[model samples]
Target chain A: MNLLEDTWKLEFHSGIPVYKQIIHHVQAAVAAGRLVDGDQLPTIRALHQQLNVNPNTVAKAYRELQHLGVLSAEHGSGCYIAPGAAEKSDGLSAREKKAKLTDLCARFAAEARSHGISFDDLVAQLKRQHPA
Target chain B: MNLLEDTWKLEFHSGIPVYKQIIHHVQAAVAAGRLVDGDQLPTIRALHQQLNVNPNTVAKAYRELQHLGVLSAEHGSGCYIAPGAAEKSDGLSAREKKAKLTDLCARFAAEARSHGISFDDLVAQLKRQHPA
Candidate 1:
């Protein structure tokens, strides 16, 4: 509760939409092991109150997460992280994995190019992330 | 605009929206210098006819580009790549550049984590891109 609140501080001037920010935060939380399978998320109404954002915004974020297979919503039981959703490494066929990797690389390249980051600079940074 | 058509072959089954595909292509074109400042983009109607996508989708992409300061639209004319927009490296203040870099890195890290790409593997692949 409080931890969730602390982790998901909304920056009003970040120029990113509230729902998008929520989506990113939730994904980051799941990636970091802060949220896990079968863990229930705050209801849209509760989150809206906590964040002072529109209920529809929270609903939108939840719907998007559900669509991505990261969250599963029950009619009356609320939302839980989908089973085995955190580990995308599992269940993917070799060809599927390769396709995902290629797609990610293309997206990374596009983003890097847009930010004016040269391939050399990107490689340098990647190297820095893993020394020796 | 055959070149544009060729460069922007849409994949309806890619699980990405048409407008997002359009946005990515436009950004890539700008990064590659294929579209420069003052280059007029196809009109919404023209693009709709060419791509056979909804005109609203093309308009949405153009509006997003304009919001990003990547494209400028005239009332009676079509969209143009915004002057000095391609080179984000030029006008960014030191703080802004650092912030942007940090944001990009955070996004990259999140994406990598989701894809189960370890730092070591990412670094290895990056090194491959830069021999010697």
Candidate 2:
């Protein structure tokens, strides 16, 4: 069974492009350890048939993943998760890391605040979600 | 001088649509108390000129805000923040609130974990950013 198809859902009306959504889901799955190194991704045609989305959209997403070094594609053999793909921090410099971290923090802050969640509440929730 | 024009930037290359981006910024500004009730938003034309985006994009954002009760349109007088808009919890059921909060938390978790930040590190960063 293709667990990726069963687990990852596509929101067609999310205003984000379909290809970007696919990229995000694949990265997220990799990060969550749901998809591991050497895991084979559904081919463009199969995914399109399952998703009822354009084949080009799946192809674009796969191309982007390949470009990001998250996936390795063989001309006729389908795509596989690249080794060490979960880390995904290979080429980032210290400054770039800091910048990315800052951006992520800002986004979290904005989202939490927008939802009327206090900073204390956010901290509590995070602690509860990932108890040490 | 419109502070919003100076502060709110649109990232055209981002896969998120322009209208959604505008709605998010407006909501974020209100949530941060930067844009309060009765605050006048830029005219659709003015903002379009300033951002060099299509006027319809600005109009669509304003319309969505109005639909959400975050902004009010007064025909020829431009848009203004709706009364008590900051506490935009008017129409949500308790179950809806929980769902939304869970979604936000999941997104934050995914982002932080994907960046290789430990949950402890994320909590520390949140504390540093929002010291209480």
Candidate 3:
């Protein structure tokens, strides 16, 4: 899995389409700087082989992203994060930022709670997993 | 989504199947005590309606879980968590426990990092979202 989707695997089940999942992965990666502006994406062939999906699926995702200005394509080279894409992806106002933070916290707490992890252990786990 | 999958929505991406996700959701919930032995599960019809999947898919998931002895069905009443289901779900040996903890931590860190949330904020958010 990419850094954007370490926990989220790419198994298209029922609701979300494969292309949408791919789009979300790239957007999340870009928003976090795992993928910065101008970073080249895997070629269509490489990505389909890596993900074991139809080539058309990857192509469709790239095309949608390009239209969204999250990605730009070179004539021969693979697609790359568009300039200012980070800003576009995050277009978060202050309120949205607060909401996003709250959502993240809720998700983190849920994961810890589901695993029977305590509050102190949860904090400690964060420190261990994400050292400054 | 249930408490077990508040953040991990039912939308299957590309690697996991719908039925498997349901099974995992129940196991996680049972291991965490959100679901306990004898707790009633939604009828297949209720679940299929709630999750908007085919009824057969829900039946298949429940059948598999029953086969694993994680759930039991009554003639008139709905399905319920089987006896000792918790133990079966968490059969995590000591080493497995440590591994699960580490995996949870890594996933937590990845989610926080992707959201650009600071470690301090993550901890604070947990406390706020999950008060003792």
lDDT of 3 by residue, B73-92 (tens): 88688899998988764544
Model 1 residue A35 lDDT score: 76
TM-scores of the candidates are 0.41, 0.42, 0.36
Residues A76-127, candidate 1: write the lDDT tens digits.
Answer: 8898889976774444443454466566666776676666654544554554
lDDT (tens digit, per residue) of candidate 3 on A22-116: 77677767766678878888788877877889999989989988987899988787788899988764545434555887987787677656655
DockQ: the better of candidates 1 and 3: 3
lDDT of 1 by residue, B1-132 (tens): 333455468878755568877876776677666778888888899888889999999999899879878899999977888998777543444345446656676677667667765454454344444323
Docking level of model 3: incorrect
Instruction: List the pairs of residues colliding in candidate 1.
Output: none
lDDT of 2 by residue, B12-95 (tens): 875457887788677667765677889898999988888899999999989988988999999978799999997874344434
Please provide, for model 2 over A8-81, each residue's C-alpha lDDT reduced to its tens digit, 9 standing for 90 to 100. 57777755567876876676567667778899989989888888899998999999889878899889899899
List ranges where model 1 is wrong by over 4 Å. Answer: A1-132, B1-5, B89-132
- After superposing candidate 2 on the true structure, give the runs of residues whose Cα lies further than 4 Å from its correct spot: A1-132, B89-132
Query: Which ten contiguous residues of candidate 3 chain A have the minimum total lDDT?
Result: A1-10
Say which candidate scores most in TM-score. 2
DockQ of 3: 0.22
- Candidate 2 — what's its lDDT? 0.73
DockQ per model, Cα: 0.12, 0.14, 0.22
